[model samples]
Target: MLKPYNKKPLSYAKQVHHLQSKGLSIHNVAWAEGILAKYGYYRLSAYWYPYRIRSGNNVLDRFKPGTSFEKIVQLYEFDTELRLQIFGAIEIIETFYERN
Candidate 1:
């Protein structure tokens, strides 16, 4: 469901909500973009192929010096599902900020 990596981060929670609203899974929210390329088919599949999957830590390692996402995850010991929740909350707060 993801597009190629972009220069910036997309909305994790917005993607989650968009996917879930369509009865799709958010397991790959961090990586997937939920972009409908053609015929409404998401580029990626729902299957969590271990071989093609990378751990969240790898993504975290690339965090910018001042980013708080890693710290938040560490503070909460967020597991897969919990990470989604935390990311969702972060998205909400960011959305609120952007609108103001």
Candidate 2:
């Protein structure tokens, strides 16, 4: 069965507020807002998933204790860089094979 999506879209400021309400520590509001604006909340949420509180097989909506927003940003940055590096390597490999 299919269900309708009931969640509403939130602005960047509201997204920050939501995270704070969920127990995420935002050391810099402006920086967090900027990241959210650039990447959108959905993309950044993946980075913060590990920081969320969990019990057994169920993940809660709230974050774990001491889960900082800056750490989430760092994780996203690291993942982006890692993906770029991996793609660069693949491109190089393809180029080498084509010349042979």
Candidate 3:
């Protein structure tokens, strides 16, 4: 059986606070909130996961010292751009195959 989705929604400010509590160094609150509002916490988590410092059993619950929000944003933007490029290439391939 699957578990129910009982998680409450967090405001952008709360999200920033959560990251701070986990040891992330956020340089600009407004910019981080804007990104959180746009891409959402869950979506952006993937980009920031690499910066986390895992120790013992709580591997997913902490971040490395001095991990900045800007770095995560840069990773997210790079992933987005790479996805677009890959999609464009796939489209071109499909068109060529269709014409053959």
List clashing residue pairs in candidate 2: none
User: Best-fitting candidate, measured by lDDT?
Assistant: 2
lDDT for model 1: 0.42
lDDT of 2 by residue, 27-91 (tens): 88888899899988989888899888898999999999999988888889999999999999999
Best of the candidates, TM-score: 2
Q: Mind giving the per-residue lDDT tens digits that candidate 3 earns over 1-100?
A: 9999998998899999999999999999998999998998989998888788877755667798888999988989998999999999999999999999
TM-score of 2: 0.90
For 1-100, candidate 1 gives per-residue lDDT tens digits of 9888765533655644554554444345543333332212222221212213236645221223332322333333435468799899999999999999
Measured with C-alpha atoms, the lDDT of residue 52 in candidate 1 is 31
The candidates, ranked best first by TM-score, are 2, 3, 1
TM-score of each: 0.23, 0.90, 0.87
CA lDDT for candidate 3: 0.90
Model 1 CA deviation exceeding 4 Å by range = 1-78
